[model samples]
Target: MASKTLSNSLVRHLMKRGYAQAAPARSETIQTSVLPNKTFIAGVDTNSPVARVTVAFRAGSRYEPQTELGVSHVLRSAAGLTTGCASSFIIARKLAQIGASVSASGDREFVYYTLEATQDNLQDAVEILASLISRQEFRPWELSDNVPRLKYELAALYPQVRAVDLLHKAAYRRGLGNSLFISPKRIGKISSESLQHFAGANLTAARCAVVVVGDNQDKAALVANCLQLTGLGEESKAEGSKYYGGELRKEMGGDLAHVAIALQGAPASSPASLALAVAAKALGNGPVTKWGADNSVLAKAIGNIGPFAAAGFNVSYSDSGLFGAVLSVPKDEANCAVKAVAGVLKKGGLSADAIRAGKNQLKLQILSEAEAGTSLAESVAAQGLTTGNVLPPATLAAAVEQINESTVNQALASAAQSKISMGAAGNLAFVPYVDEV
Candidate 1:
């Protein structure tokens, strides 16, 4: 009877902490807490059969020292390669047996690992995560085994990745970009010792956020297990400087013409972030016909190209942030495309329609993600990383509601007046020069 009551408590705790039924009709809620030295957020959707767990550390390439470039990326890959309990291959096989998936990635500001599995395997997945996080043996042999494969994969991806890297390099060449995050030279210099040191320094409980999104009745035990494994320590107080601020540059080259453009934008917490999103969508996103009617200047300029093969904008926020656009076009139309894009940037600020569309799109995107346990987990984890709290649906909805035409226009005007930088990669020889708009 005591065991049954304890079990019931655990189930209740899990439900309170964002675990929910796995079914599509069920609404999901996220639970947040600051436990000892660590902060955690979880979401549980009981109606679905799949569950997701994400753990993030507020450390990434931005935190690496100049001498230890690419260490974060290397460490992320190595985390999956070997933990004390088993080889990465063995873990993968086990996860597959239970219909689970695991992966990790490093970004400019953070490194994250995720696990997706069914309800029955949640405990196993949690244990695996704990082992990887706390008991991983960063053996030399494991690093040696994975380095060649990592290098090969990076080499293969270089051609496609070069343009994106070049853009970031051009925009943020000073601080963060000079670090490993966007520096190709630094990425090539990653070593095993550096990776181990980086992990040890950054992957502390204080710097971590664990998010569990699914329907699970045993959440209290899961939290307790995590706390025991991670051993809550003092919070990390590492501070870093800003990354970008300067004149723009353009590089000309490659078979498919590429243009990368950036302007100073809002911080993640700023209301302007929504405005920027709306502006990006208004210019070049989704089915062009949806927003880009024949009368729209952007549509007229770019011409109806059926579905855009590849075009999107990113509003990257950190200590500093930028609104950036990347477009791929035929060699002959590259200059035209760049100019057209520039014109859009210069003219479009924000509109009621654009704001409405962006809000709807964002809401829809979030809803769609909720259907997938892995995506839901990632969303919750990412929110924890960025805001030091879970993004509540009500808060999100309120923000969306507050994004009116006036607000969007204000954001757009700010974007237009902000400093601009440009980067390009491909076959052209000479960089294109443009006068300030």
Candidate 2:
């Protein structure tokens, strides 16, 4: 009886001091600030054991000049290579010793480098991340060694990705239209000097942001201070992309027809972008649950035609965006499916129940992504870089609450009236062009 009493007392003590493992409180909100040098930083301390920090820059493909088309792809491949202070061997050996990992990813608008580690090791990991982002030294032989990786990534592009790449090309014609992957013709031709020039011109403090998830705001401030890298000049202005409605089609033999038809949508900075996001959900995305066939309106409308896949696709850049749906149908079903999907996009009207369902789904998506550290960091960084302001998931969901039926309807109307652009690949013999759609 005395031993049992002592054990009960010890359990109470541990629980009081937070020694017992438990989920962190969700009441804590996101914190954001900017460094003196103009680098943005944000943090959401869930008081969890794992942590993530990201350094992002407006140094993506859209910023690349006409002379350097594929530098960003090569730049992503160059992560973990030699920096000014540490060799790739040392970076790898030390990070592995600490059991931490880092990654690099990019799109048309920005490039992000993220570091992940246990909460205790995050400070040390930040030091290495600082070196990686600020002290990049693009060596000639090292870049040449990475050509195979570049080729492999490009080779891995299947029909869907190829179609999307062409879709961007048709929509913007340039700038936002730049391909995320290296063009096959430009492979092995991009020079080290080109990369150095692009980095030197674009990765400036004005264009950089640091975002930390799973840690405190003070830690985020420290991380941003550490990344106040100099030497890169002020943000270099890139030519603005104007939407030019056109078609890009690839004639290839295949059983499926992959296509994306779109019109210019609201920019990420605009209030309508969120409603457009909700509309994308309303338009439908295949299946939400496991082992279940899709019940979305798009699926039901086109599913009867043949076995195929259809989903809404919305991409918002800093100043431009694309709103449309993609359809992949058997070549034999392409004629009807393509025209039907395009007609739906151009029609742009949804019922109140559909809008409500879309808002709920989007809210769930936003909150769920916040719980994912990498995605959370990406969201914070992108929001910071593009708008110079960051909204936590909770606040963002609240903003979604402000969106009503009329808001989404107006966004859809605006998009419908915009000129049309289309991209098609894989057995294009049956797919319709923009004019036909």
Candidate 3:
């Protein structure tokens, strides 16, 4: 009897493991429901003890009106201030008692409130998130108190960080061009009234979603219901962004030089966006280890240009995208690598072997990130906002598999023809002009 039981258990384990290896598509399961108030909920029951929930609003820096610039940044910093139901201290205490961790962040596209806690505390977590978003008290004193914190945080941005910010300004110049961090100059201009008005107009049910990654389906559903009852306003879309590629340059003190060159790419909803992602993978996405070497096309092309580090990226938004490479090198050696990078961009060619390798790497990265709790929740919320649902892993794999040499060449060629959005910060004398590249 004992021998028979042991054999059965071994067979069961092998069957589960073998099936997962044989069919990766079946490994991910998603359940989605849209509430009567137009609040969307995407839930994945991973059966893990720890859970993550995020309420994502379409409110972001890009949505800020001209008169209310930097209000989104202030709103993010003031996430848990005094709500209608509870003070900031009481809110924090409640979450602490339930052993939950919470944070809020804003970007060019969205602002999200994320809560991480045990499955048992999920209900309390949801209530806290709902209260924080709907009942946020935009008192003048509370808003003023967080301004110094924002200033201190903004001061810590390094040259590389500043260069990326300048890159967007060079690329879009307006909507998507909005800075992710609040400018110190504009911080004083933002007022509590502006934040309250911004939240009233943008933080509505039509533009929000609740995403959960955990084992308890019941608690997630309850959270969704709680959000619907908040009576948030109707959804309103932001103005579409137009890409007019130009150049932005700034001189700073660092001995190293930072440069970003970008051209117009495809939007997030476009099928060509998948091809661009695959092309980026082939170009290079950084090395796996500190000591590991990258042998991608871009890496090999610039190998003789002197000691420098570079990575290719494809930044997609709802309406537009920026595809390019960012390079960092010694001040004296910057231009040499920039020329090499431009040459590689103009000739964007990919072999069959490289395409296959890129597909595998992209697949691995997507699946690996989905395995984490908070990451999966964020993915669900962000994708739900964009496409009304998340793209399954298998669908993503299929899209990537269809990419070929011609597809990559065409994507890069289009970018090359567009006006280049160029940025250089630190040791500006050695940085090349956009036309020169």
Report every candidate's CA lDDT: 0.57, 0.76, 0.71
Cα RMSD, each candidate: 10.1, 10.6, 9.4
Candidate 1 local lDDT, residue 413: 81
> What's each prediction's clash count?
23, 0, 0
The regions of model 3 sitting more than 4 angstroms off are 1-26, 215-221, 228-237
Name the lDDT value of residue 323 in candidate 3: 72
Q: Model 3: how far is 215 from its true place, Å? A: 4.4
Better of 1 and 2 by lDDT: 2
Flag regions of model 2 displaced more than 4 Å: 1-27, 231-235
Reference-based TM-score of each model? 0.81, 0.91, 0.89
Instruction: For model 1, give the 10-residue run with minimal summed lDDT.
Output: 14-23
Model 1 over residues 1-437: C-alpha lDDT tens digits?
A: 00111122221221111111111112556556665555554556556677767777767676766666567767776766677789878877877777777788656666778877787887877777777776667777767676566666565643224454555555676344633332345443566566656666778766776766665424733643573434333333334434453433434444555556667666666667766665554553423243333333344556654322233354444555566555555566656666766777777564566557666755554455556665556656656667665555555655666767877678778777855666666644433544532
